[model samples]
Target: VLPAVVDTAGAATSKTQVHAEAPDNTVFNWHLGDKGATEAAFKAARHVTRLDIVNNRLVPNPMEPRAAVGDYDQGEGAFTLYTTSQNPHVARLVLSAFIGIAPENKLRVIAPDVGGGFGSKIFIYAEETVCVWAAKKVGRPVKWTSDRTEAFLSDAHGRDHVTHAELAMDADGKMLAMRVHTTANLGAYLSTFSSSVPTYLYAPLLSGQYDIPAIYCEVDAVYTNTAPVDAYRGAGRPEATFVVERLVEVAARELGKDPAKFRTQNFVRKFPHQTPVIMMYDTGNYGASLKKALETIDYKGFGKRRRDSARNGKLRGIGFSAYIEACGIAPSAAVGSLGAGVGLWESAEVRVNPIGTVEVLTGSHSHGQGHETTFAQLVSDRLGVPLENVSIIHGDTDKVQMGMGTYGSRSGAVGMSAIFKAIDK
Candidate 1:
């Protein structure tokens, strides 16, 4: 165990380092947008609100934990691995290219009957790597399955941040600018997309649903003695939303206005809205959504409801939380520029049988997102076939075409979108 000799006063420097390569336990440092523009906005604003927020860490506790089995085909001189990975092709790529286990074509990966993976099973883990290596050496199938305790010990964790944010507003309460400084705890190692999440995913989303004119963000990714951090559920978008929306609410409270009204007043009211932080929202009706929510919740009757609850010896209060996230798995070229190791595209192949049945092959390995029913529906609706006539095939790289796999809630967006395009072709 690493000695606990760090100072509590200097929280940034005192922690015991987990990796020798990362001295002082720093993983990455990243920034975005113009600091000058942010400064000017703050200087020109009539009001400024500051808040510090911490989005607590999470362990992705899927029903069935991570598992893998490896075997070698002696006749063909090939290897195969069956694991509960979200992206088997990416797993194949890492095992072949980076891990140096074998060449790409020589490896056949099958991700069979996985129970669930809420963004945690999307990486190449060490146990599976060792199993594959050991199988070739021992000339037998090597299997490894993680129990709940082992999953807690080994699975990539998510969303640990200590962040400070400031929002600037004009005299009329229109938002002018925003700035954020976040220290992200990346745990022990950079698990797959860990280096990119807090920077590319978090910073660009600092604007949230608001129409802030200028925004600047900085993230200091630090390593600690814990499981490596990675994408969990909404990943960085949730953390970014917490900071921006909390600021919006706190600012509304400071200026003596309804939180809903304040948010609606600053809503991005145009198509192709671009935030200073590197995101271009093509189309949205944020004001309309807020209006519908307020009306549905009966915002005007809050006082009466609170009084009634107090009479009954209870306390009641309404909360308004508005947020926006950039989903659709992002753009490949755009993310590539931001230093992503892989592109952000999914793959699919539609095989039409001569007997009028259909078999669809996709890169997405759906443990619990219902790809079998959903992807089948996509083909059924498009090809004019009955749902039963279409069968979805995935998870096996030897059978399915190469793909980026699923995360960021992209199974419907990019994965199914790829299947739709394949149908068109």
Candidate 2:
């Protein structure tokens, strides 16, 4: 179902309808999903089955919130910003474009003592941009830090989607057709990975591990009077998994079969399985994993446990979930094909010092992901060097050349993959 974007005045009058108008110079088309003609089709669909409306807006409540200290040197006309960020190089590029500053080389970004991000500190915030511009404009050092409340209201939120899904099954309980209509809340502005989250990340995973033959999804990303909704943890995959797995379980219950058996029966037991939603799973052992889990949990004994619980006047239900996730940020071509504005490739540079020590500079910044230890271990394992002899450097724009930053569980798969390439070179 398409969400209705209304002004404060329009919402007061009509609560459930979208109004479209020409974009003015002050306002850009920042809505999440379809626009123009595509939006018209979403508004016309009838018979929405499973309506999921989520409106829990969580602002970034970092313990230290957000802080930025900037200094511009008049002699070189260069600028440096110390802030809490997962990717300083990306921030510097964004700041240069937004505030009309110097190129990336002239802008140095340092992330020092960042408390926690939880996906909020990954973006180039307006506060950071303004502070850096003010430092250069006023010809003095400028510093700005966000209070707890400010962080709460301004920090990006996650997973605000209203969705309706329907599954059509055949006589043997095989899923024949599936359809989903979603209205994703984009808040006021579109965050960096915001638009692609619902469309590419969310929709592509709708196929799940099941062998559903036909599937269709229509997502209408809406603009709401709230904070921007972006990636959090598993991002769109968790939301998609919730819908697909829950529906599969419900279908199993309706068919009067064990959820695990039903899933095993429908599981795609093949490699390079292609779904209708444009994702080709490289490899998986669905039935093996399910069987192993059942053995681990003593599936046969659940009936006795349930009966004992019933005698004690307790209603207990045991549920099993077997899910498959596609992570590792993916290839650049894959991301670009799916309408991503940025490249998904990571960067790494391995340099051997004159004293026989090794240094690795990576684009993947670590926010408690333990890059120092893990990266060093990789270097030690690969080059036959001791872990202590390798030092991994990151999160500084001046220290690294180019980077796409880290998120989407991509640090190990994409970032380390890049590091491996560097080591090989």
lDDT for each candidate structure? 0.85, 0.75
lDDT: worst 10-residue window of model 1: 2-11
For model 1, what is the error of residue 387's alpha carbon versus the real structure, in angstroms, after optimal superposition? Answer: 1.6
Estimate, for each residue in 1-425, the C-alpha lDDT of model 2 and write its tens digit: 55545332233234544324412101222222222333343344332224343434445576878889889999998999999998787898887776667877789999854767777778888888877779988999999988878877888888776667666665677666567776676666778778777777887788888886667777666665567788776778888887787777877887787898988988887777877777777788889888998999889899999999999999879876677676887575556667765767899999998887999999988878899999999999999988899999898888887887777888999999999999998
Per-residue lDDT of candidate 1, residues 293-335 (tens digit): 8888888898899999999999998777788777877466457
Q: For each predicted model, how many residue pairs clash, with residues at least 3 apart or on different chains?
A: 0, 1
Q: Candidate 1 versus the native: TM-score?
A: 0.95
What TM-score does model 2 achieve against the real structure?
0.87
For each candidate in turn, give its C-alpha RMSD to the true structure in angstroms. Answer: 2.0, 5.3
